[model samples]
Target: MLNRHIKSHSQYKKHMCTFCGKGFNDTFDLKRHTRTHTGVRPYKCEICSKAFTQRCSLEAHLRKIHGAALHFAYKQRRDKLYICEECGYATHSQEVLHLHLQDNHPSSTFLRKASKKMEMTLQKKQGEDQTENSTADEGSR
Candidate 1:
């Protein structure tokens, strides 16, 4: 409604894009528009690790890209609270939750260590096999 009204009248454009000379009446509108030229992403999705310049864009990504069932926080305020799926720990910060998952979650931490061990074992076996092959070739010569 505001955009329509602004467009109908030659609105005094206060906000201007740095990259382009395009003018916007609202500062928020100008910032959101400027992201297109700057390729700046300030907001990021915790689930998929996708980034977006605008908060609305990130919210839209959660709905359309992630196919998440949208729920209003008014009705489900407790659900809005970030809780660990692995443990019962709760935190508002996403970075804290990510650290908690990596440090405290048994599956993630253990699996990472186990995977590294397995990779090292495989590499050692390959090195031994190569050495044996080289020794055999030298002996035959």
Candidate 2:
């Protein structure tokens, strides 16, 4: 089993392909590169009609362009999902969910950030009120 986080770049780490004198980051990437030579298209985009040899690339394109709308139907159908309620898109990972929010739901992202700011403000106000109450008790005694 390969360690997902472990970096093993000695063989194909830097994408050095012996078959066609090309390099890729991963095996799928190498396969995609090989497809360039063989002209094998496995995945096709429904929105833009772009062809890719790997399914991941097609998914990336779909998520990047039609995240909220196009990817909307993807979550329920997918085995694994990262749901983003802000934009209602299901992604493969939380990182992709964040990316979707940034790329597709910018307004919701801003609102979330602004709501956090408001929460901090309220916390600070509560702390100030507690200190004021303590000082008032000290003066009364």
Per-residue alpha-carbon lDDT of candidate 1 for residues 51-104, written as tens digits (9 for 90 to 100): 776656777899998898777675444323333433345567645565666777
Per-residue CA lDDT of model 2 for 1-141, tens digit only, reads 265335445454665665567765565456446666656665668777787666667778888877834444533554455444443355566455666666777787434753565568779999999999999999999
Report the alpha-carbon TM-score of model 2 versus the true structure.
Answer: 0.34
The TM-score of candidate 1 is 0.43
Q: RMSD for each model, in Å, please?
A: 21.6, 17.1
Steric clash pairs (candidate 2):
9-13, 15-23, 15-24
Which numbered prediction scores highest in lDDT against the true structure? Answer: 1
In order, candidate lDDTs are 0.66, 0.62
Estimate candidate 1's alpha-carbon lDDT, on a 0 to 1 scale.
0.66
| Cα-based TM-score, every candidate | 0.43, 0.34
lDDT of model 2, residue 2? 66
